[model samples]
Target chain A: MNAVKKIVKAREFTSFLFLAGLFLVVGIINPAFLSVDNISACFNSSMVYTLIAVGMAFAIFIGEIDVSVGSTMGLSAAVAGTMIQNGSNWFLAFAVGILIGVVVGLVNGWGVAVMKIPSLIFTLGTNGILRGMMYLQVGVEQVNSLPKEFKDMSSKTLVGRFTVYYCCAVLLTIGIHFLLTRTKRGRYFIAVGDNAGGAELVGIPATRTKVTAYLICGVLSAAAGIIFASRIGIVTSLSGNGYEMKAVAACVLGGISLSGGVGSVIGAGIGAVIMASISYLLVFMEAPSNYDNAITGVILITIVVVDALMQHRAAVNNRHARLAARTSAVPGGKEGLEQ
Target chain B: MSDKTPKLGGQNGLRRLWNGPNFRWNLFLLLLITVECVVFGATNSKFLSLTRIFASANGDLTFWYVSIFVTFVMITGGIDIQSCSIVGLTSIIIGVAWQDFGMNIWAAAALAVAVSVACGALSGFFVAYCGVQAMVVTLGGSFLYSGLGLLVSGLSSTEAYKGISGFPDSFKALTKTKIFDLIPLQMIIFLVLLLAAYLLLHRSKYGRKVFLVGVNPSAAEYSGVNSRWITMSTYILSGLAAGITGVVMTSQLGTAKSDLGGNFTMTIITACVLGGTLSTGGKGSAIGTALAAISITLLRFGMPLCFGINKQYLDIPIGVLLVVVVVGRAIVSNPTVIAWVGKLRGKGKEAKAGA
Candidate 1:
């Protein structure tokens, strides 16, 4: 039992260790890397990934994948940019952005729920479609010269340290944790993911639950896109080309099982920070920028493998528990259990 | 194989013509060609000339020219994002062997293919034997191979972006050579590749194993099949094909760049999905892939020709088409329709019983 607990703790804390290790490495490379300003900037920039990963955690927990999130984010960004250019107010532009995200999410949910298509293929398809739509709508002109309000968010440093985006990231993380732990919808998501048939037997609508997962993913991804647009102050067709991978890597590194039914919003956020720091540290260390991708890949794979091993150990422990329970029920049974 | 579901025939053919994978592929291709001819002709009458038409088509075809290997990659229930990097690596190698190393073009191409196969084998070993997820393994492979490509090219030239140009005329002649001075050699190569891929995938016994492994590895293993090696072999074939594509691209463009195939993985994967290769694996066809490549290539060139569409927005149509095809397939296969039809027929019986 003690060993099992140890394993669980290790599995949970590995991401934190990696995050700390990256921080230390960066600080070592450049003393100023640990400065409040630098740390704030890194966290602020990583907010996009954190937002998307939190959204993706819901889908991953439900045993589904959403590669289309990046493209969906792009769609929202393009929509928001176009709206902003057309003299739309901030409130209206934000609503349109969120609406596009929800619509894309609905398309994903509808395809998976109603059409019974696999999530991966359906999302892959939509990834292309959303990207195509962005292209058709935006064309070649980059949406530039943004309004003062949006630019202020991108350039402003909040609370004398962190940017507003970083604050948003913290708020999102805390909100997700509360949603998962306190809300009925959150428990329903886990219940459905843990066993769909069982959830259905208990009067839970598994399909609806799964669709909700995708819907949340859509909204979150769109939010991430809005933040990204604000940060960069530029809208390009390929802006969100590879952001999906970053989210997936973060979730995987954060002990979110790809097989689903388990993940933590806090852990995923930490994973995002770790990933962001790798690139940040590489620059501090004077390493080639390209090495950042390679290192990030390595860290992601390592975390995934460790998670898999932890799960395997848990399965073995469960099997052993059943065997011990059976033996203990027998009369005059001599059961010598060795750990 | 199930007799209960009869193949689409007669009236079904018309329906299938619009809805089936084959129909969509051909329709998209035709629509693009028509639009291209009309727009280019209006802009410049010379664009309508047979020579110019042939040139445009040839250029369009080159974009997805490497899609032949992507079909095999899809069949094995694996994806090789690294194949794009392999293309770059091979192109440079081809250049070095033919120009600097002074090897024959054919021999150089063979060497390039061999290297690609080795890289593929490494990735396949990890995926099939070690049970690593295809995505992670390939993503890592992409980085490793791309880095190597840059390094190798950098060894030969300082400007990695400019690439290694100035290949001998003979090497470019392979892509440019005309049979009867009417058709390009590149076209012939594309046809031969398509036919060979079809035969290997659809007709061969080993090919069937690939499908089984992809659909369900546990079931295949239980049935006394070594699904691992079969899956591994497909990656090897893909890598080799990437090498061939690299050589062809280098020869055709008269340059070899480390970044030649960068950002190409998404496009190839898009082509595979567009061709109806289910990402979940176990279902796809060479003919479907061929048509898909043609359509994608046409879209790349044709959209720009007619609508003055930006090249970057190309992902939009490909993305939309992918979603439409997948969602359309899903809707048609929805069980509610058949259940509704059964209920409608049942209502007639209930009414007669009441009477």
Candidate 2:
């Protein structure tokens, strides 16, 4: 019972429970969706979102926002696709893709952290610049015929039915989760986000931590771009458009506060799985895909409201518990109060 | 960060006024606009003609109208990127209601405004009451509303790409109608909106409440200001403004589409920031936003016409301008940085004197 309570009390655990409940509810509606193959498929489909959400978690953890991730992903994916399609070395193409993310991340960090510009405006500017560069890079032509090895990454299976890409992403997320929760440097992000001035006073390098957070965010987003290209097998101009919002939604669904420093990437990964599964769930329920965006919105609002209400309830309960314990400790105080 | 400033002695009030951030930014924009006109006009004489300038400026009026309202949201330290999506939603609502539901154009517009306001309320509820971050909630709103617009598009007989057209001749003339056979009608509408925005933001009690919330919400709460309602109201106002822009844009373009005004958020934001509105909130002006909008509009159109730059590359300059101006504002507004720059100048002058 204590273990169960502990698991229930952990905030990220609730997100996992929500994910399981969502799948269970959807499975009850369509038994076929409950099949092992279909369920693993959901996790497989979540690879891109999981990557993006994890990347965004770094920024959120550091108490900043990065709207530029979508564009960074797009530009990297386009560059990678173009290079591979042009018969360039795949390894070098991947490196260049990641390098693009690093540069964009550095610029974003410089603007927001070093320059003290608002994160939204600074990232929005970078978003525009990167998107424009993407358009110029892949002008009016779809980059197709990516190397078979790369394109097949999504389909490559792991132990049992899990796909290779998702397996890698899950492990990477778990590894990052440990790094965040257990390491000193990793905790710096949470410390800075919790209270920047307080952290600075405590000998934490707040600015450096924020910039490092952004750099990690950028690199992760670039990696997601490569994975996205592999899965889609074609790079269109609109390939990664509006994805930053989805990633944000996923992180929020995972119980990551936009205010920062409150949730784990593990929760984010779970939330990504939930977010990525919604469209599939809609398909199972025979709803038009056009409803996907509205459903996501509804889900986002509902989850946040529920979380807020839960917090409110918890505070009330704690107060009542404190009163009860105080009365009990006073021996006859409860009986005397009645008199 | 404080409201206090050292007063200059000997009636240097004018110089002190010039040192004020808002005044300085506006003056910079004024000078920039003037320089742009001369350079572009010198390159192409057609650009110098007053008639041509206003005529070219007509399309940008839609962007300027929306930027004013967005400036209000920013002044509260909250952003409404969803405004662009609201434009699409309103346009689609107007189209669907009038064409599909057999409603009158006027009634359809009212319906659009009401719905857009409701969308604003929905997003505002989360940000204001639930404590959700404004950016995240609005980004979700952007998705939900745009998706709703597309869903509405699915209902129209016209294919999505084809868009709905065939408006009454009067409706098409709404924006193009020449005022006194000389001035464009868009100019008149923009001026009216600008004036109204100026009074609402700078001359009203509610405006003070907005600044209070933006500067410090906890402080505002302590002072009995309902910061939640104020934040919510700004978003609602932004939505109504977006609705108006939608009607104007649809009229001006002579058609309605689900994707209309799809990418105008960047331009609106650029205008607001360039207009000297601090993204951190508590400082912005309608006139400044208007001037910034015009400067950007001129830069975008004039560059293509004068230098033969491709229209598609315009984002580069706008993006660069937003970053540069914003960073410059940050540096200039910091007293320590200003003192450093002054010290450097002092050392330079002393070295020159010794030489």
Best by TM-score: 2
The TM-scores of all predictions, comma-separated, are 0.83, 0.91
Model 1 stretches with alpha carbons more than 4 Å out: A1-12, A26-36, A82-88, A305-339, B1-66, B92-111, B154-156, B306-313, B336-355
lDDT of 1 by residue, B195-309 (tens): 8888888779887888888889899999988999998988887887777778888888888876677676666777787776777788777777777776676566666666677
The DockQ assigned to candidate 2 is: 0.54
Candidate maximizing DockQ: 2
Expressed as tens digits, the lDDT of each residue in A1-339 for candidate 1 is 998776457544777777778788779878878887777767777888889988988888887889889988988888897788677898899999999889988888888866777787778778877877877766777777677678687767666777777776788788888888799877888787788889989998899988898999999999888888887888887779878877888887777766677777787887787767777777788876666655765565555555556666888999988988887787545344432
Query: In terms of docking quality, how is candidate 2 classified?
Result: medium
Error of 2 at A324 (Å): 9.1
Per-model B-chain TM-score: 0.82, 0.90
Model 2 chain B: lowest-lDDT 10 consecutive positions: B1-10
Deviation from native of the Cα of residue B320 in model 1, angstroms: 3.4
lDDT of 2 at B161: 77
TM-score of chain A of each: 0.91, 0.92
Tell me the lDDT of candidate 1: 0.76
Off by over 4 Å in 2: A1-4, A312-339, B1-21, B49-62, B342-355
Model 2, A1-339: lDDT tens digits are 999897688788988888888889988888878888888988899998999899999999888889888989998999998998889998999999999989988999988888888888888788878877887887778888888988987799997789988999999999999898899998999988888889999999998999988998899899999989999999877678878888888999999987777899998899899889989888988788888887887788778877877777889999988987888789898887667
Candidate 2: lDDT over CA atoms? 0.86
